[model samples]
Target chain A: MTTDRAHSLKQLRRMLLVRRFEEKCAEVYQQQKIRGFLHLYIGEEAVAVGALAALRDDDAVVTTYREHGHALVRGISPDAVMAEMYGRATGCARGRGGSMHLFGAAQRFFGGYAIVGGGLPIAVGLALAEQMQATKRLVACFFGDGATEEGEYHESLNLASLWRLPVLFLCENNFYAMGTALARHAAVPDLCAIPRAHGIVSESVDGMDVVAVERAARAAADAIRETGKPRFLELQTYRFRAHSMYDADRYRDKAEIAEWKKRDPIELFVARLKAASVATDEDVAAIEREVSGEVERAALAADAAPLEPISDLERDVLAKVVP
Target chain B: MTRTTYREGIRTALRTALHDDPRVFLMGEDVGKYGGAYACSLGLLEDFGPERVRDTPLCESTFVGAGIGAALGGMRPIVEIMTVNFSLLALDQIVNNAATLRHMSAGQFAVPLVVRMATGAGRQLAAQHSHSLENWYAHVPGIKVLASGTVQDAHDFVLEALADPDPVIVFEHQYLYAMEGELELGPARASPWRASVRRAGADLSVITYGGSLPKALAAAEALEAEGIRAEVVDLRSLRPLDDETILASVRKTHRALIVDEGWRTGSLSGELATRIMEGAFYDLDGPIARVCSAEVPIPYAKHLEDEALPRVETIVARAKELVARRG
Candidate 1:
């Protein structure tokens, strides 16, 4: 709602940060720094940043493995996230979770769960907790279009709807479940119908436009809070990078990637900001510079972080019981 | 001492947990209106109301995952997965989420969740309805596997397991639910982590748990007729096995025989045998032996089912052979 110059710039800076951070990760990944299933949120930045901006800090967030953008936008620092991927003692998860699993309980960001549709039920439970406590705090669960193919996804939707819990089922439909395209996997390629079939209030948004994403997400979140029911949003987006670092990318065409890259969320947002006279060319340049500097420092700090000793390997298998 | 059936003991535990903890809730198929598939939660719905006693649709994976989520969200959730056979549908949630959440999240999130399910083979419930797969859960690192065979354990382990800060799997043996026993009604006697010496002897250590505990005890009793004093050790908690008590029993008895209702191949009995070999091999008078179920799908026929599962006859025979060996 507060889409003034300052707030608009903040969102722009956040998107820029997510973009720059992943770009740096992609760079360092080639240098053999970050390892293991790096599913970059390179193009889907608008979905995480825009949707996260629509909710309160206390509202929970449960997202997928491809959640660097979501975690960064939801308030985890680049250093902590980077250090986690670096497997450092000072990391957000104490170096336990790598790129696929980022956790910050203090922020109420439940985690970046790796399993597809695995986080959906968790998000429903978080909302169930909030509902039982009468906290009015909603949970925004982000998953890909691939998750809708999972049974947990359908069950979660039904439970959330049946109980009328506050949850926003944000599906980043980037047209691919790793390598298989939507049509190849889903019998009904249209995702909105599935949630609508479950009697959930559903909407579709242009995920490339940050303004559109934020607007749709805000309305969805507001409705959930008021009705205490789940809402589904199908954000039509595309991933600018491979699914993971190891992906051969033989499934998608080169022309398709080029077309999607042309409508990159960060660049599109900057263009809209300039057109609306919300931010100047100089303001955009300053934001880019600031994000780049922060990313550089975070990468350096993470590289210097220490790996936990083998003695502490068994520390978290179970919580220590008090005698 | 309170004389109650194992079913009543479980019911009491559930009743007490729901009454005491405001955050605790039980959800599973037929748990509410139908009073649970096993009737362990016979009148919980009427007592606690709908919010606390939830009867879920048969979406095991989602409900189990929801339990893990609710636990992570700071609510104590107890999810019932009807039977171990049906639990396979939610294996992803149990193995991947509940068990892996704590360690993978670097302890930032502890899944203080309890999952209860009926387990083991008996009755006329054929192949699909009967099986003992606690070994699969015990194989995981972050979970505590509890097998409640007696009335006291049925009443106690559920209460104690809830106090644990990690995921605990409670397997209530289907056959043992009707067995009535005496419960020392007071505070829980001890931590559920250690094995309990049900009947002590100096000849053979007959190790077992869950439905097989009774069979092993009966076998020990029958073995006593022939002057073979066999000790019975009930492994209350299967995952964090009480190796010290097991070793101590084997050290004292100088012989060991494991009776388990599960299949012999890749069984909890095998793990126990390995642990005994590692800890008290020198003290053993002969090769460690185990009397486990026949490696076949459980049959509904009374005669076949009885022969397939570990029996007191098999246990006594295995013990006599082990004790007779001169090695």
Candidate 2:
């Protein structure tokens, strides 16, 4: 709906932010500044950035553990997300939610759920609430390719379609469900077709291409917001990093990894911008420098932030700043 | 005070909650068209239609997880697990997802979700369906546990739980459904977090909740004939144990006995005894006691099932022992 320049620039900023933030996270994890399973969204930035760009600020989002990218794209400050990864009190969840559970209520980012296929039903529920209240807000749910194997995913799709709730199921088909390749796990290699079984409108697009992802996501998000019906989008992508910090480089062949790495979403987007004369090489480098600066500043702030005291451990267990 | 069965009281609460809030809805196996496995949602499907009154696939873990998700997503979701026995299939979602979401999110999210299920023994239901596992749910943090023992509680607890900003589990006794009584569906208010004094006495404090509540009340009525006054404390909320209520009663009676329908070993009774030892040990004049289910699987036969669960006679005997030993 918006102009092509605005969309391209927003996508550039988001993709760069995710890449830089996660690269910093990887470095921090090595330095022990961050702990827990840090699943980086290094090569899969287009799915979160492109899809989230299609959503409004009031619209909610639910995602899986690989969610640093989702949080950044959904408008959570880099400082808060970085501090959360550092387990600092200034973090988004006041440092209680680490890498796997980043939550930003202000932005309507429901959570970064760690449980596989866990965010699906939640998105459906949120959509149900919106539909019941007659609100125009839509719920965007992001999960991995592996989540389709989970019963919650199927159940959520059926419930959403059955109720005609306004929700978008965005499956980040990164070709793996935590080291289990989609080919090995899924009977049908195509994940989008699965939603059709639930009577949901489904589409698959190349996740490495930002414009394609944004176009498809915008169309799907608009349909859900206007019609109060669920839509599914499968973004075929791949992860350049391991499943977690403990994962060794043993899941797939190096060439396959290299093959997918060549289609790097961020790099291709930057190249496309150069070819189309939308932005110069200097402009792309300047954007990279800007993201690196933001990541460094966030890391510094997080390093300076205080660790949550043990006394307040029992606090915030039952109640939150109620909406 | 309008008269209603325990089943009808719960239904009224559901009807009221659904009518009051647009966010509140029900989901579980047979909760919609089939009218629920236990008939708790008998007419909700007709009144609310399939949108508000939803029937889920037999995927307990996913549906329960979805309820947690739905709550996190700003909806008040009430999930029914046919019975407490079947809830085990979704225990991981309950314990790991629902119970830990708020704390794990560092207060970013508070799951206003309620999970309802039938519990305790009595019906000729076999071992799988007859076990009372409130103690297991109570053991977890980040979740509030409730047991509805009266018609008022059956109606009041669901509304209160729905109002809470945290996850709550309501254990509805299967046998209590048929029991009839007046149900005044009152406005939602915080029923004090502490235990309630069902019947006051001076000899021994009898702490019980849910299925054992009626048996304790009956035991109290019978114990009155024996000249031993037993103070019956109904523990409505189990997790955030109204320790003050139990401790004050223990101080008044100087002796205590916990009546629980759960098994003897590692039960809620065990936790109550430990709490008494820690909080009211100095105030106690005698040893703490408990009359829990026998340490065995609940048999299918009606007679054996009655023997395995805590009955009025058994609670009376346990209370008499505590009173007699009040040296």
Candidate 3:
């Protein structure tokens, strides 16, 4: 149908932008430009692009440090993100927070927290605010399969389910948590089943397929907004890059990587759009060119950005103290 | 003026906060159905219902993180760790997330959270549960630390902490929980932000707080027998320290004696001594004397535990030595 073609084309563009953005980050990381733990969201573009499409602009998003893709898909400009990665004042957090911590107040994107499972409770808390204030906004919390083992994840889920907070927990199960496979860390290989144990309604979708991810996200978001009950989505995905700049790639095999690479989300979505005649090769090339230029501009802006002076260190510690 | 016990004063503050604001709620282990481990939250469950006075599981990190999350979500959450020793389990959440969120977010988020727990020794509950670690928290950048040594502050500071937009830790002394006093039943009135001069004198300044306050006060009184005047100051707030009060007292006395419950090495006394040296180095008549607990884990035996913490006798001797010495 026409609707399917339109959706696939849109997803193709979004996924291309994310994939290109992360690839650019990897290239720059090799040049000794951006430092610290830079976790690339290269192959997991569908998880962010597809799921982000289902939610409204006002919905809050809390994600892990591998969140450049999420921040970009959530409408934070790639230039600001790249500049932030460069630790520039022009970036999202004014260069105070780098890759592991990207903030976008305008878009209601809470941040990219570095600590595994740290953002779960924060996301739940944001949903709790919406619930208590009678707001219709839903909070979409994104984390990796590694965060599932953290106690904060379980506690936040239990509290969210118990209180019936309007929250959608989107887990990007890339099958690896910082080079350690999910099978090695988690007792339950099926991450979706873990949320169900906390009485949360859950669904596991093929994260490599943008259409499936979008479909599940749409249903989950609608249910949460309507009933004020939490829903969980486990998107089965993979990471093409190492966990960080320091990874030796010893944890996983090349055959496994090749198998997942064969089903690359960006290429598959572009192919689907082409098959339906909704997008030509030229259109795909144009989107990629646009995304590449934007990423480049962001990096340029960041490189020129100034670092914060040491004198203002004591500022913003407390909002207001009633002395 | 209405008279009340230390426990009653804390209860009154919690009751007033809950009654005044719908967003303020208390969450901790044994704080609800069990009526709190210290009985400071006694009858609150019956008054405010189980929703506001939540009883959390023994999972300190998870619940503390939940409290931080709840605070982030617009609720003023009061997380109570039963003791200072148990709070170590939740240190990751307290130090990493709760303390750093505001700075990391560039002032976008305000953690209006209050974490209250019992601290210090003398109850024979030694080693694991009897240590005082407020100094460790005070050393952190973002958090405000308060040690309630008196009945009035134990009752009033909780209200002040809830009103503060940053995270605050209120350490209630375990030994002083039962010490009763007449409390004025009017609006809460105590400076939660500054130290108070409990017993003003001229010769030497006895700087202390929490479990060591009573000992310092007693030592000051005992020093009066030797014709020496020792000013006693209750360091109510430790973090945004009442630097002016301490400096003024030290400037006037020209001598300082620090009484602390924590051990000697890298103690809060060392920090205060550095501050005094930096602020009023020329005013000192002699090197600062520090009366701190022996550098050993508090033993379970009553006598050994008593000997482990800073005692009135040790404080008196330290004061005498400082007064007798010439710079």
Best-fitting candidate, scored by DockQ:
1
Best by TM-score: 1
The positional error of residue B27 in candidate 2, measured at the CA in angstroms, is 3.6
State interface RMSD in Å for all models. 1.8, 3.8, 2.2
Query: Which residue pairs of candidate 3 clash?
Result: A79-A298, B2-B183, B3-B182, B3-B183, B4-B183, B9-B155
Residue A50 miss distance in model 3 (angstroms): 2.0
- The estimated TM-scores of all candidates read 0.99, 0.94, 0.94
Writing each residue's lDDT as its tens digit, candidate 2 over A1-323 gives: 22366667767988998999999999989999998789988899988888988889999898998899999988899999999999999999987789989888899988888878767777877787787678999999999888998877887888888879888999999888887888999999978778999999999999999888989999998898778899999999988998888999688899999999999998898888878878778877888899999999999999999989989988877773221
| Candidate 2 lDDT by residue in tens digits, B1-327 | 888899989999999999998888999999999998778899998998887898887878768877886777668989999899999988878887788878877776788899999998899897999999999999998888899899888888888889888889998999999888877756644473557999999989999998888889999999999999999999998878888889999989989999999988998999999999999888898889889898888999888888888889888888888888846
For model 1, which pairs clash?
none
Candidate 2, pairs of clashing residues: none
Model 3, span B1-327: residue lDDT tens: 677788888999899899999998898899998989999899999999977898876678767877887787778988899999999988888888888888777777778899999999899997899998888999998899999888888877888898888999999999988987767666647778889999999999999998888889888899999999999989899888888999999999999999989887888888999999999999999998888888888889988988888888888888888898977
lDDT of each: 0.90, 0.87, 0.86
- Candidate 2: residue B193 lDDT (0-100): 58
**lDDT (Cα, 0-100) at A224 in candidate 1:** 90
Quote the positional error of residue B206 for candidate 3 in Å: 0.8
Could you tell me the TM-score of candidate 3? 0.94
* Model 1 chain A weakest lDDT span, ten residues long: A314-323
Look at candidate 3 and tell me the lDDT of residue A16. Answer: 80
